[model samples]
Target chain A: MKAKKQAASIAANAGAWLITAISLVPFLLILLNSFKDSLGASEMNLKLPGLPLQLTNFLVVVEKGKLLTSFFNSCIYSVASVFLCTVFASMASYVFSRNRSKINRILYLYMVLGITMPVNYVALTKVMMLFHLNNSRLGIVLLYTAMQLPFSIFLIHGFVAKLPVELDEAAVIDGCSPMRLFVSVILPLLKPAIATVVVLTFLNTWNEFVSPLYFLSSSTKWPMTLSVYNFFGMYFKDWNLVCADIFLTSLPVILVYLLGQKYIVSGMTAGAVKG
Target chain B: MNKNKIYPMWFAVLALLIYSVLFVLPGLIGIGYSFTDWSSYSNQLHFVGLENFKTVFSADENYLKIIKNTLVFTLGTTIIKNILGLALAVLLTKSIRLLNFHRGVMFLPSVLSTLILGMIFTSILNPSSGLLNTFLREIGLGGLAKPWLTSPHYAFKSVMAVDIWRGTGYIMTILIAGILSISQDYYEACSIDGASSWQKFRFITLPLLLPTLATTTVLNVIYGLKVFDMIYALTNGGPGKATTEVLYTAVFKKFGTGQYAIGTALSSVMFVFMVVIGFFMIRMMTKDEVQE
Candidate 1:
């Protein structure tokens, strides 16, 4: 029995190590090859980058990929979308959770459908055209915010439903206006849920590809994902710069994930576990 | 009390305005457009009634292939990701050293854009000078290193492998959370009964993990059904349309060619698929939870 257990432990360790290696190798390849010349990166061996390490790949990627503009576009879209989604979602969640009206319940059910449904891109563009918002940053931001509202409302509703009603009673008893009550009392308590919303919305908007691709026709308005994609298309032969572009495109989200991994895991799992 | 009711209603207004305008309205218009001849060339819209649907179903039989590809992609990635994720979760939960590090490494790719992943793998899968081919040839398996992205037979599988590689970590993390929530006492009890590892896992772990598994499966299926960027980046539905031309890509192509009505029809079909699957998944999982 002891020998059997020992062997099982060894096997498990080996499997874990193997999985880790599989996961790490791609990132390692990207990192190592991003510094090498095109020939070295194409060789794609797992060796340390050679002497006279070329950092020009980053410069080349920025210049050729228009990475700075793409990065700026990503920031604007993600930040504005996150802000809009969080505020609107929080407000909606507060109402949905706090109210018991039949209308609210039905409306809540209706909004939750967005969680599963893919956006209707063709029709959406038409609506954008009607509003004269097509091919604009605001158009994309509003769409992202709308698309994300369902999930954010679902999550924040769960969070809000768990908050004690006695606090609302106390605030009301103190002659607090409903707006002030939410602002001064409820919003402060919703920090954790809001953090989750911000992280998730940020991640989604930052890494979004399909919407940006379809909605925006102008090259200057393209986000990092689209820019990297187009850049990769244009510069497929110069793989070192391609690697650099890829890394730069992924860097912000990767950093965000590494920094707020706990929030991300908890937020994602919170929604899953509840559902 | 009336004031309170009115205030909450006020809070809901902005969300409803945006949601109704951008999401619900577009969906309804999309369904409406499917029944009409809406295209780039035509100035006026004409009610076409089942024409686009007919094209999707019978006229263009290739659409059926795209639908099949979509189903295959969804089921293939969902099943593989769930199994691999569950296994990884079970393996990593065993007090493994550097478990967090391993978990983080596994999950790192999921955070990156799927487009970027596609680009990375595109180079890695290149026939002449790719890493995968180089490694395979070095190990005396040159025959296996075929044109992954270019060949019709291999393209779907290659794309699927990339999807699974990028996705497994995410589902693994979710399952890890689920597995951690299962109390150790059950395992202790099983051990006291002299239950083998397989027996304990079969009886305790699998049954309890079903709810989480259901959630992950639904999420994966939804994502798989909506997959566009990865495929677009990898092959653009390509090598003679060999790989999966999922509905979204089809819609994209249709729209590109100014086939607005057909694109809207495809979008409507996708929406229905999502609704039906999403509803059924939740219902099935709810039943599981109740039985438990």
Candidate 2:
């Protein structure tokens, strides 16, 4: 019986390592190929890159693939939209929690309902045109804000409800205006939820591809994901360049993931548990 | 103390206005336009009265097949990801070496852009000289290296597999959290009764983890129905007619070709369908939020 159990334990270890390999191999391929010359990367194999690694691949991709423009575009979209979502969601959800009027309840539900409602990108074109938001950086930012607000509001609304009503009572008694109370008293306490919101929203907006694909038509306005795909199409044969471009595109995300894994996991599993 | 005076309602105005105008209004207008012949092909709007819906529901059109593919992909990926995620969750929760590293590595794909992952998979699954096929040949399993994205019979499955790969870790992460939250008292009690390891899992773990599994399923279904980026990046709904096309990609095509009426109609189908789920989803998500 002990031998049988040991065999099972060994099998479990084997299974875990195998699955880890599946996850790590693709990334390793990208990293290895990014340093290879074009001929070296052509096979897309796991072999080590040649001596004097072609670090120039990143330079070529940055120039030819227009990586700098898209990287700037992604940064703008992520930062601008994350700021919009965090501030707006905090303010809105705070009101929804404290007010709880009939209209507010309905509005809160309406906003959260967007968590599952699929955006009609087709008709959205008409709205964007109506507002002159089509094909611009601001349009992408606004679209991402609209896309991310529901869940952000949901996350922060729950948190705001937990902040004691006495705090609000004290702030008001001290002649704190609503804006002052929120800024001085509540926003500091909401730092944790706001952090989660910022990180998650930034990641989502940074990784956004569809909105730019639909709305931002100018090549100059493309985000990293779009531009990387474009580069892949044009340089499909030069896997080295493509690897360098994707690796660079993914660098910000990898950094954020490592730094904010806690917030990311919490945000991801936020509504998952009934407990 | 007036609640209204302290917690003013106007604070919500910016978010509501943006959401209403940009997000909610488009869905409402799209549903409305489904009745009318609205298209870039013409400047005039004429009430068409369910003609678009008829086309969507018609037996002859590939729209029905596309709908089926979407459902199949959702159900297939959700179930497989949950099962595999559950297994991995249990394994990683064991007293394993580098436990955090394993879990983090597994969850990496979930954090990356799905479109980017699709591009990487496209390269790996290329017909010749791709890493996957090359590895298979090196291991003497070359016959199994099929044209992953270039064949009709396998295209849908291939897309589904890549999605499963991208998504399983997320489900696993949630499941691991759920498993960790399970109390140790039950295991102690079962072990005292001489329960086997499988028995402990079957009786204690599965039942307790059902809620998390359900949550993961909900997330997966919502993601699957609206899936576009991965499909767009990998196959663009190709390798044959309607083989891998879901509603979103098909709607994009309609929108691209100036067929606005059909596109809006297709979107309205998904809109109405998901709105029903959204009601339940919000309730599940906020079950403990209000605490009123």
Candidate 3:
């Protein structure tokens, strides 16, 4: 009986390891191919490079794709969108939490609707044309902000509601205005939730593909994702270059994840639980 | 009461204005456009009534298939993701070293862009010289090697596998949070009473984690309905549209083909579908929450 139990334990452990390897293989293959030449990548060897690493694919992808311009464009959209969305969400969440009126409840429902509503680009295009938002970075940013605001507000409101009402009471007694109170007292207290919103908005805005694909017609104004797609379309047969482009496109997100892993993990789990 | 309320009602009004203009107004306009015979070719727009919906529902066999595919994809992904997520969460929560590393590895794909991941998988799943097939052949299991994305029977399955791979970690992390919140005293008592791991899991863990499961499942359902990037990148709804196209892709195709009104109509159907489904799910989940 002991021997059988031990054998089962060993088998379980091995199974777990096997699953992990399987999970990691796709990523590992991409990583390996990113360093190989076109011929080598076409062969799709699971093994590491047998020859010296070639920088040519990376260079070609960068040059052909005009990656630097697209990277900068992505930065503009991501930063502006995240900043605006976080500020608006935090402010809206604050007001919605403090006021327990019919309007607040209705607004809360309205915001929740945003989460369910898909971005109706076909319809939005008419509005965009009306506002001349089509094919513009500003236009995309506004749409993103509008789309993200609901979730951010929902997340922030959950945290805000739990906060002690005493803080607001005391601040009010001390003659603090609502704006002042929110900025000084409530805002400081809402750091973790704000951090959560900022990271999420940042990630979503940075990696957004569909909006950019539709709204931004000019290649000069395309974000990294659209740029990567264009690169692949233009270089359909160039697997090596395509892999290189993929690596470049993913670098910023991977870097952000590594740097803000703690905050991202906590924020995600918190949002999940409270949301 | 008045003195504390410095921002006044207009601030709320302002926020509402942005919400209405950006989100609500667009959705309403979308419904309106769905009724018209609008397109890029002509500015003389005319109301087409339910013609577009009729076309979508009856004109093309693919539309119905897409809807079915969307349902399957969403149901399949949500069920599998949550189950696996819960199981993994329970296992990883055990007293194991390198738990953090394993957690990080699992969560890695969630952080990467779907477009990039799609490109990577496209190469990896290629049949002629793809890593997956190459490995299969080397192991003398070459029969299992198949053109994953190209084969109609396996295309949707392939897309779902990639999605599961990307999403399971997220669900796992959420479940872990749920599991960790359960106090250990119950588990300790169970162990003292000679309750086996499976019994403790089935009784204590399962019931306690219901709320989290409900919330996570609703979120997954919303995500599943809106799936576009991964499918768009993976197969572009190709291999003769064998994989699930869903409403979003249908709308996209119509828009791309310059049938703007029809596309907006398809989108309207999606809007109504999502709203109905989303309302039902939220109500169900919140009712459960109240019970809990």
Candidate 4:
């Protein structure tokens, strides 16, 4: 019986190793080929060091793709949208929590619909055109913020409800105005919910595809994802440079995940549990 | 008290306006337009009841194939994600020293953009010099190597495989959270009864993990239905449309050709389908929750 259990354990370990290998192999391929010349990398040989590794492919991709500008655009979209989502969600959540009115309840339910329904991009494109917000970065940011608000509100609402009402009462009795109370007392205490919102929104916005695809017409204004798409189309033959570009585009998010895996993992699990 | 009532309204005003105008309004308008003849060439709006739907269903047999593909893609990915996710969750929760590291590595791909992953894999799966074929040849399985992205037979499965690969870790993490939440007392009780490993898993873990598994399955299904970016970036419904062509892709193509009304109709179909699926899933999950 003991031997049988040991064999089963060994099988499990082997299975785990196989999964890890499969998961890592693509990334490994990209990393190794990114250093080789275009032909050498495309040859798909894994054994030898494609020796004398240099930064040529990376440099070319950066220069040609204007990686810095697209990176900045991604950062702008993510940061601005996350800020919008958090501020609006926090305020709305605070209100929803504080008020038990029929209107608030109905609005909360209305907001929850966004979680299940796919965004109507056809009409969205038309509306953006009507408002001259189409084909612009700000338009995408606004839309991203709007798209994310429902889930953010849902998350922050639950968190806000748990804060004791006594805190609000105390602040009010201490002569704090409603706005000032929310600003000074409530916002600071919403740190955990805010972290979740930030991580969730940032990742969503950073990796957003459809919004930018429809909204941003100009190549210069493209986020890294869109730029990468266009880059793939333009340089489909140059596997080495393409690998370099892929690595460049993916590196920042990977770095962020490595740095704050806890926040991301917690936020995601929190979302799943609530969802 | 009056201030409390009014302030809440004030705080909600901005979010409501933006959401209503940008999200809800557009959705409603899209649904409305789905029944009208609102193509780019048409100057006047005409009510074309059921015409778009008919065309979607019968005009070319391609639509049927698309529907089939979408269902296959959805059901395929959903099942694979939940199964693999549960397996990983069960295995990784063991007393492995590098458990956290493995979990992190598994999840790393989930964080990357599907578009980027698609583009990366496009080259990696190329027929002639792709790493996959190269590896297959090296391992004496050259017979299995084929044009992964471009082949009609392999493209859909390839796309689904990539989707499952990227998504399983996410489901695993969620399941891990669920499994971790299961009290040790239950396992201890089972062990004291001399329950075999298979018996313990089947009787204890499976029952407790049902709700989480349900959650993952529903999430996967919903995501699968809305799949666009990865397919767009990878195959783009190519190799002569052999890969899975979902509703969103159909709608996208309709709009590309200035078929606004038809595109809107396709989207409406997608929306209704999703809502129905979501309703049933919620009902099923809630019932399971109540039973638990």
Candidate 5:
């Protein structure tokens, strides 16, 4: 029985290692090919580079794809949208949680509609036309905020429910107005939940493709994902540049995930476990 | 300031106004436009009741195939994703070294843009000189290798595979939370009752996980129905449209072709379909939650 158990343990360890390697292999493939020359990469089948690293692919891809500009656009979209989403969502969540009026319930249900509604891009386009926001970054940002509000509000409401009402009472007793209480007391206590909101909003905004693709028309204003499509179109035959562009586009998201890995896992699972 | 006298309705109204302007009004207008003959070609508009719908539903127009494809893609990906996610969650939950590192690596794909993932996988799955084919030949399985994204038979499956790769981590993360949240006492009790590992999992883990499973499955179904970027990037509904075209992709194509009314009509249909399904799902899940 002891020997059998030992054998089973060894098998389990080996299996785990295999799964881990499978998870890492695609990323490693991209990393290595990002540095390989056209002919070398095409011939070599995802193997590590032979000797002297060829930095030409990265340079060529950057110049040809205008990766820096794309990166800047992505940053603007992600940062602005995340900031707006977090603020509005947190405020709405606070209101919904504290107020028990019928209006609050109705509003809560209305917000939840956004979560269930299939993103009507056609309708959104018409709306954008009406607002004269066609092909504008602000247009895309506003749409993202409206779309993301439902989930963010849900998460913040869950967190706000657990907070003690005494904090609100004490702030009022100290002559703090509602807005001041929210900023000075409530917001600080809701840091963890706010952090979760920021992380999720930032990640989603950064990785978003469809809205930007439809809304933004100018090549110069294209986000990283759209730029990848442009690169593919411009260099339809050049596999090397395409691979390099893919690597550059994916690098920031991967870096962010590595840095905020803990928060993302926790934020994603928080509601699942509790509710 | 009278706290009770102060109404929060004003703030709620502000949010409602923004939402109505940006989301609800457009959807309502879209439904109206679907009935009218609207397009970029002419300023003249006519009320063409059910004409667009008829054209869409025509058998010769390939709309039905698109709908079928959408359903297949959704059902296929949702099942595969949830199953794989559940399996991985179970494996990772065992006390293993470097577990956090493994978790990070697994979740990497989920964070990257779908368009980027689609492009990267396209290269990897290329027919000539792609890594997939080369690896197959090296391992003496070259016969199994094909132009994954180009072939009609394999294109849809290829898109589904990449989606599964990209999404399994998310579902796994959720399922892990669900599994972990179950009290340790249950597992200990099962052991004391002479329950085998499989028996314990079947009796305890599966039952406790039903709610999470329901939530994840519903979310996956919605995602599957609305898939766009992956399909667009991977195959573009090509190779004779062997892959599922789905309504959204069709709308994109129609808009790209400057067929605004037809495209909006397709979008309208999708909106209604999604709303109906989403309502049913939420109702069912919440009802189950209450019962539990």
Candidate 6:
């Protein structure tokens, strides 16, 4: 029985390693090829990068791919959207959760229903043109904010319900203004949930591709994902440069994922396990 | 305390206004535009009843194939991702070394831009020198290798495979959370009754996991239906006539060709389909919350 248990443990461990390898291998291929010279990376194998890594591939990609401009654009979009999305989502969810009137309930459902509603990008152009937000930075930021609000609000609404009403009463009795009650009292208490919102919003905004692909026309204003794709198209033959470009584009997301792993897991799994 | 003052209605106005104008309003107008002769080439809108949707549903057009592809992709990916995710969740939750590391690595694909992954896989799935075929050749399985993305026969399946690779980890993480939340007391009770491992899973875990699986399914369906970035980056709905063309990509192509009416019609179909799904999803997700 003891030997059988030992064998099972070894088998499970092997299974786990094999699965891990499958996931890691693609990323490893990208990383390895990203450092190789064009000739070396041409075949796209698992071979180690050369001894003197062709770090120049990154410089080439940066210059030709307009990495600096796109990276800056990506940051601006992500930060602005994260802030707008979190603030609006939390505030809306707070009110909706605290004040559940009949009308509000319907409105809440109406807002949350956007969670699954596919954006009609064709008709959206008309709306964008009507508002003169067709190809502007502020327009895209607002678009992302709107896109992210449903899920963020859903998350915060569930969180707001767990907070005690007495806290609100205490704050109101203490002569707190409505804004202060939310910003000073409730917002602080909502830190964990807010963290989740911030991480998810940032990640989503950073990785957003379709919206930019549809709306943004100028290459100068493109985000990293769009720019990377454009770069791939133009430099299709240069595997080293393409690999390097994608590596750079994916770096921020990977770093953020590593840093905020807990919040992301908890955020995505929110209300999913409540059976 | 006045309910009006503390939790002001203005708080929600920004969110609702943005969502309405930018999100929901477009959907409504898109449905309306679906019936009209709306196009970039024409300035004036002329009402044309069911013309575009007819083209969509007609056997004469490839739009039907696109719709079918979208449904097949959604159903296929959702089911497979759920199964694989459940299996991985179960495996990783066991006594394994570096378990968190494994989980983190697996989940990595989902967080990164699917477009980038799609681009990466294009090279990996390249027939001759791509990593996959090369590896197969190295392992004496060269005969097994085929043109992954270029061939019409394999392109849709390849796209789905890449998507499953990206999404399975996310589902696993959710399932892992669900499994963790299952009280140990139930398992202890089962063990005390001399329940075997498979029996414990079959009786206790499977039944309890149904809700999480449902949630995962809902998430997957929404994602699968709206799939654009991956398909756009990987296949771009090509290699043949509407082979891998899902709704979003087809809508995009229609819009790209200055055919606004058909694009809006396609989106409207998706809008209505998703709303129905969204309704049931909301009920299922909030069922326990409402009770509590």
- For model 4, the stretches where C-alpha displacement exceeds 4 angstroms are A1-5, A44-49, B1-3, B59-61, B277-292
lDDT of 3 by residue, A1-275 (tens): 89987776666556556656767777777677778888777775667855788777788888888999999999999998888888788888777777767777677667767777777888888788888999998988888888888778877877787787788888888998888888999899899888878888888888899888778888999999999988888876767788788888888888888888887888777545533
> lDDT by residue for model 4 over B1-292, one digit each (tens)?
5655435578888888888888888888988988889888977899988887888889475877887888899999999889999999999998765788788889888898988888778777889887788888989999999999888888999999999999999999999998888889999999999998789899998998887787788778888888999898878888785456777787788778888888888788777777667556544533322110
Candidate 1 residue-wise lDDT, A1-275, digit = tens: 89988898888888999998988887888888889998887666577888798799999899989999989999999999999999999988888878757788678767877888888898888999999889999999998999999889877887787788788888888888888988999999999999988998999999899888889999999999899888877877777888888888888888899889998898878656633
Show the lowest summed lDDT stretch of 10 residues, model 5 chain B: B283-292
TM-score of 6: 0.99
The TM-score measured for candidate 3 stands at 0.94
lDDT of 6 by residue, B17-98 (tens): 9999999999999999999999989899999999988988999999888999999999999999999999999999999989
Q: Which 10 successive residues of model 6 chain A have the least lDDT summed?
A: A100-109
Candidate 3 Cα outliers beyond 4 Å, as residue runs: A1-13, B10-15, B280-292
DockQ category of candidate 1? medium
Best by TM-score: 6
Residue B201 of model 5 has an lDDT of: 85
User: DockQ for the candidate 5 complex?
Assistant: 0.51
lDDT by residue (A71-182, candidate 5, tens digit) is 9998998888788878888877788777656767567666766666776677678789889888988887777777777778767876777787777888788888777878
- Candidate with the larger TM-score of 2 and 6: 6
**Interface Cα root-mean-square deviation for all models:** 3.1, 1.1, 3.2, 3.6, 3.0, 1.2
Q: Over the stretch B97-211, how does candidate 1's per-residue lDDT look in tens digits? A: 8889989999988888888888888878888778889889999999998998888889999999999999999999999999888889999999999998899889998999888
CA lDDT of each prediction against the hidden true structure: 0.86, 0.92, 0.81, 0.82, 0.78, 0.93
lDDT per residue for candidate 4 within A34-101, as digits (tens), equals: 88887787664564545788579999999988898999999999899999989988998788767757
DockQ of each: 0.59, 0.79, 0.52, 0.53, 0.51, 0.82
Candidate 3 docking classification: medium
TM per prediction = 0.96, 0.98, 0.94, 0.94, 0.94, 0.99
Candidates sorted by lDDT, descending order?
A: 6, 2, 1, 4, 3, 5
Specify the poorest-scoring 10-residue window by lDDT in model 2 chain B: B283-292
Residue pairs clashing in model 2 are none
What lDDT score is found at residue B64 in candidate 2?
A: 97
lDDT of 3: 0.81
